[model samples]
Target: MRGKRTTTGAAVMIGALAVTGLTFAPTAAAVTPTTATINASCGLFGGGAATLTATQNGTSATITLSSTAIKTPLALAADSITSKLTMVKASGGTTVFSGKKNPAMAAQSPVTVGPLSGTVASGDSLEFYGGSLQMTIFGISVTCTASAKQSPGPFVFD
Candidate 1:
């Protein structure tokens, strides 16, 4: 009889722990329009359509830019290009994400940068138009600006 009671109590405790774990589990974050596009022009270097991908976790976020239209004129070693990307806020003002993060690229390879980290708030709308992307490669600074607002609208974070 005592053994039966002990077994039942342990089983109940295990069930309670399972329920507690489910109650405290983290939830998946939601960010509207995970992808955005812009027509960027980097004078003298190159430019065209570029894709920007965004992800959010709480107040921390990341943005990655990739473009087949913009290619490196020369080979670039991994994490060698210094890049700073500015973004406009719909409510006014701007935010910047700068880093020297990239993969090695051969001459004429597509340009890709980031996983650039930034801080964002819920309901914040970020667009690239009024902002700019500056990349310094081998001492040459190339500035790229969005010709217009990003398509599919700005990224709305939650």
Candidate 2:
């Protein structure tokens, strides 16, 4: 009878643990992130490419733009240039996420933008626009604006 009671107690404990395990299990709403690559160019006289990556978690997103190398006709310094990254809906042309500040071009470091709130689904467009850089080269101020856009393409969500 003692063995039977021990077996019953063990079984009850196992049942309790099983129930507790279910409570701690991950639910369906767990974080699942999606990512996309961005490669675009902008500017006229001295055009530069903006290479960036975008990651989306639910309705929040983050964009990281890597510093780009520029080729221009004038003697320019990286500090004089500023770049901005944006994401927009392809169908309705609504701006979803825009970078808050324009970082200098010569930073040579990755610039991160967001946790911007938006529904970033498949087929959204990415844009990179740089404000014209102005600097006094030999007592003359030079300015140039550059912008690039990526077309909506196939994207998969897991």
Candidate 3:
């Protein structure tokens, strides 16, 4: 009986150690580029010297705009980053197209805001693609001023 109890205790301790090793061991965290898809069903606007707002999946986003003399002599307020989205007449400005995640957009063409079959202009897309994330945000804030030379400005999402 005493020998059996000793064997059982040893087995239980080994089992516990094995279980702890598997459960509590630190894992090697690897950063991989996850190709996740999102449904961009919100419309973004280039408010002439105003802030643009986008909302989807109960999340909201706001991007600041700053003009830089429009580069091609276009009448822009002048700000940091690429204010020249499109060379259009600035009549319609820019807008976001609603579409599903399609890899073809990244490979085939000049990566517009959304899908191709839509009214959104090629230049009229969110500023996120310019090395920032308009998505993956829950809240946003935008500020606009009339006397200010710079139109909209940098955006911060939480």
Candidate 4:
């Protein structure tokens, strides 16, 4: 009985010591986050003032313009012209604003696109514009402006 008590006490002491050692042991430190993704579509806001028209089927986006500051230089093909555009990331990224002008006509006003001209944050997107495109039937100059936002959500289409 005496021998058994001593063995039992030693076992208890060993367990206590093991627990104490584990408590003091060190392994690694803390980690941080760097990247994030937002999932949404029909961007909430900040598409900008320049107008836009788009039809999406996969990665290809087709857009047209009806107004611009300079109305003389190039005649945009009714359907013969196209440009690349990206969804404006509300986090402060790049966006595209396309429009047409035939200043040679001498009595026209530039069309205003929307989401309306306003301030945008990171990661919001939207587009505007529609209808058959027209021109003076000759090559004329066309100027385009664009807007975009970053640090926000993803395209609802994807």
The clash count for each model shown is 0, 4, 6, 33
TM-score to native of every candidate shown: 0.84, 0.40, 0.24, 0.26
- What digit string (tens of lDDT, one per residue) describes model 3 on residues 115-141? 112132222323322222131111231
- lDDT per residue as tens, model 2, 1-158: 99999999999999999999999997552222234333433233333453444565665555544434433344334343333333444455544444333333222333333333335554454343322223233354344334443324322222
| Candidate 4 Cα misplacement greater than 4 A, ranges | 1-51, 68-88, 95-142, 146-158
The reply for model 2, stretches above 4 Å from the true place, is: 1-39, 70-84, 101-158
Better of 2 and 4 by TM-score: 2
List residue ranges in candidate 1 displaced over 4 A.
Answer: 1-28
Please state the error at residue 64 of candidate 2 in Å.
2.2
RMSD of each: 3.0, 8.0, 17.4, 18.2
Q: What TM value does model 3 have?
A: 0.24
Sort all candidates by lDDT, best to worst: 1, 2, 4, 3
How accurate locally, in lDDT, is each candidate?
0.91, 0.42, 0.28, 0.33
Residue range with the least summed lDDT across 10 consecutive positions in model 3: 69-78
Tens-digit lDDT track of model 1 for 77-141: 99998999899999999988888999999999999999888899888999999899899998999
* Clashes by residue pair, model 1: none
* Candidate 4 CA-lDDT value: 0.33
**Residue pairs in collision within model 2:** 42-147, 43-146, 43-147, 132-144
